[model samples]
Every structure is written in C-alpha cells, then in structure tokens.
Target: MAITDAGVMYGLLAVGAGLATGLAGIGAGVGEQGIGAAVVGVVAEEPGFLGKGLFLMLLPETLIIFGLAVSLILMFAWTPFAAFMQ
Candidate 1:
C-alpha cells in the first residue's frame, strides 16, 4: 500500500470548519450587540418596557448557540475522507 499524505486534506477541512465557525460567531456577535444596544436605549427611554427589550435582545443569541452546537457535532462526527485515509 502506498502512503498518502492525508494531512493536507484534513488540514483544509479543518480550516474550512474554522472559517465557518468564525463567520457564524462574528455575525451572531454583531446581531446580538446591535439588539442589546437598541434594547438599552429603549429601556432608558421607558423603563417599563425593559421586559420586551430584554427578550428581543436575547433572541439573536440563539443563533450563536446553534452554531456552537454545530461545531461540536462536526468535531465528533467521522468524516469519510478520514476513514478512507485510515
């Protein structure tokens, strides 16, 4: 059997995964930050509206949580290429 250098292939895949996670996190952070700032402004104007503002600000955070879950899943799951290389 010939020894194939699978390191490059796995490295590319890992890089892709890192990029996906980074982009996802950046997007989520921006979204959550905007919402949080808006909520703070709204609450400052009308303290009674704090509850609604808080809920809205928190909603965008779910995307980040989902992205994290996806990252975890990818880390644990077996890739076909990894198996082939083995």
Candidate 2:
C-alpha cells in the first residue's frame, strides 16, 4: 500500500503537535524544578510564603498551556471546527 499526500501531511502535523507538547512538558518540568527547590527553601524559612510559593510553582503551567494550544490547533486545523469558529 502507498501513503497519500494527505496522509503524509497529517502525519507531519501529528509529529509537530507531539513534539510541541512533549517539549513544552519537558520545559515545564525543568522550570518547576528550580521553582520547587526555591519554594521549598522559602517555605522552610517562612511558612507564610506558602501562597506565594504555590503561585510561582503554577507559573510553569503556562508553557504546557501554550503547547496544548499548538497541539489542538494542529489536530483541528483540517477539521470542521475551524470553519465553525470562523
């Protein structure tokens, strides 16, 4: 069997979305690592920093959000949803 051009295009898009999400997740993990360490240290020094520490830790989630958006766009670019949104 032979793969069609449409299949090849979709395959590439899938790869792109996968890469975006995977890399973003990895970046988020790396970001959280430093923030986590700092938050732990800060909390150890002053428990009052709990709210601030948690807030900072959550900031890394933005990376994952962006990745998810890219993934969604890639996955839906050819779908009817695109037309519906316009």
Candidate 3:
C-alpha cells in the first residue's frame, strides 16, 4: 500500500522511540561495563566493600528506566497529539 502522511508520521515516531530506547540501553551497558570492572577491582582488594561497589554499578541502570518511560510516552501518551496532527 502507498504511504500517507499520517502513516509516515507514525513510522517516524516509532523509529524515534526505538532509537531512544536502544541508545539508552547501549549507554547503560557501556557505563555498567566500566563500573562493573571498577567494582570488581575494588571488591577484590577489600571484600567488605561489595555492597558499596554493587550500589555504584547499579546506578547506571536508571538510563534504561528513563528510556522505557520515554518510549511508553511516545507510544501511548502522545497518541492524542498524533491524532491532532492528522
């Protein structure tokens, strides 16, 4: 079928949402990798520091959560604006 304006807009929005989620996930993964390495090193030096190391490593995970929220908003909360645009 031929693509209409509204269809194109919807596709663009979907792509944008996907990008946001994907990028955030990538960033979180990269960040966690570094932090995880550091945490391991720190823990290796002092076993009692495990809890603090774990906390620091987990902090990067918020990027994924924020990305999920943005994706959800784009998928559902933005529907009204999409309809209005069309």
Candidate 4:
C-alpha cells in the first residue's frame, strides 16, 4: 500500500500560508485601526497636528508588509518539509 503524496505536502503548506497571512492581517488590522482612531481623536482636538497623526497612523502598516514578504518567501523560495516529504 503506497501513500499518495501528491496533495499532502502542498495542502499543508497552503494551510500554513493561509494561517500566517490571516494572523498577520488580523494583528495589523487591529493595530492600524487603533492608530487611525487615535489619530482621528487627536486631530479632532487639534487640527494642527496632522503630520504627527499621519505618522502614527502609518507606523503599524510595516508589520503587515513584513508579514506579506515572509509569506511570499515561504510559499515560493523555501519549504523545509517539502524536501523531507519528497
């Protein structure tokens, strides 16, 4: 009895990739949402601080970008278990 490995490794990798992206997006979304809300609140009180608010709002986006880069690298460039399974 031989196990068909055609989809096993690929499926696992896909699931992992999905999880990585989902978690990263969730975290980034929450962080950026909070930042944006805070910036809005600050701006409401002091319209002159627009530059500072914009900077604060954008800072959390770096995490999402980094996560996307890591996911892309994992999906395309490297797969440790793929070698072992094959």
Q: How close is candidate 1 to the true structure, as a TM-score?
A: 0.68
**Candidate 4 segments whose C-alpha is farther than 4 A from its true place:** 1-4, 79-86
Q: How many residue-pair clashes does candidate 1 contain?
A: 0
Error of 2 at 67 (Å): 1.0
lDDT of each: 0.73, 0.86, 0.86, 0.76
Please provide, for model 1 over 1-86, each residue's C-alpha lDDT reduced to its tens digit, 9 standing for 90 to 100: 54366776576656766776777788878888988988899889899989998888778677777666666555556475548456
Lowest-sum lDDT 10-residue window in model 1: 73-82
- Cα-based TM-score, every candidate: 0.68, 0.80, 0.80, 0.74
Candidate 2 TM-score, C-alpha based:
0.80
Clashing pairs in 4: none
* Reference-based lDDT, residue 56, model 4: 81
Colliding residue pairs in candidate 3 = none
Question: What lDDT does candidate 1 reach at residue 36?
Answer: 92
- Model 3, residue 59: what's the lDDT? 95
Compose the digit string of candidate 4's lDDT tens values, residues 1-86. 55458567667667777777778888888999988988899899999989989988877777777777767766776756545455
Give the count of colliding residue pairs in each prediction.
0, 0, 0, 0
Off by over 4 Å in 2: 1-4, 78-86
Candidate 1 Cα outliers beyond 4 Å, as residue runs: 1-4, 81-86
